[model samples]
Target: MAALALRGFGRRCLLARLGPGPALHQTIPMATTAQEEMRRFWERNSRSGRPVSPHVSIYKWSLPMAMSISHRGTGVALSLGVSLFSVAALLLPESFPHYLAQVRALSLGPALLCSAKFLLALPLCYHSWNGVRHLAWDLGKGLRLPQVTQSGLLVLALTLLSSAALAAL
Candidate 1:
């Protein structure tokens, strides 16, 4: 029935598909240029101070949601950090030990050294922890909302502790 009705669209018989509605010969308005029509629509919406789509502000924050986004961010940061470090290692005239000696020569305080170590360890630790969380998810575990929240908190805690432990070294 639908196929026959669709075929009717190519003829005036489309009016019959409307089920006793107005005749097909009636005139209806159409935008000749879709671009101009869309531009006008956006312009009108802008003037009316109405949002055309949902904004980030409309979304309510949740623990798992935040952790998930941070997991991806840390993964990107770790990859970029390692790649840039490798490229710099290849291009630099000095070797790794030379750079270590240069840093030691700076005589930066232990507090500063620890802070720098923490900065280097932070993304790695977070990424590693979150990766394990992701692995668990793949194994069909910790998928419930409560378990996700608990695991997210656990990942954060472990990241902090492990990063500190690494920095201490």
Candidate 2:
């Protein structure tokens, strides 16, 4: 039944295009297949002489924009880390403490251990602080340009301080 209706609709469109006076003024909705839509898209873009993608490298980077991208990057990195850890936990024959023992057995220097801790904590701290900033945005606060820049700076400072503190431990 739906196919029949569509067929009838196509006939009406054909007749409308071929039919008499005032037909041009009266509009008929034309259904498009994906292929036709894509063909038209490429044709229009080619005629426009614009690049398919925007020239992101040419644009000046701003603090808020950098923070926004970093926020997403940290989120992805954190998620993947947790997922891999979970999978390792499930798949490894021995438990996490066994791995911890092995790592400790290396008798790594204090500075190296602290650096590793800092590296692990850095993303966590950044993501957490930025998350709070996003929550503030959701609450309709610190949305102004100056406020955004201030919040970004605050997030960076807090992330460094907290990560350093964690690394010290």
Query: Model 1: per-residue lDDT, tens digit, 76-148?
Result: 8878988999999999998999999999999999999999999999899998999999999999999999999
lDDT tens digits, residues 56-145, model 2? 545678998889999999999999999999999999999888999999999999999999999999999999999999999999999999
Worst 10 residues of 1 by lDDT: 15-24
Residue range with the least summed lDDT across 10 consecutive positions in model 2 = 50-59
Task: Report lDDT per candidate.
Answer: 0.88, 0.94
Error of 2 at 130 (Å): 0.2
Which candidate leads the pack in lDDT? 2
TM-score of each: 0.72, 0.69
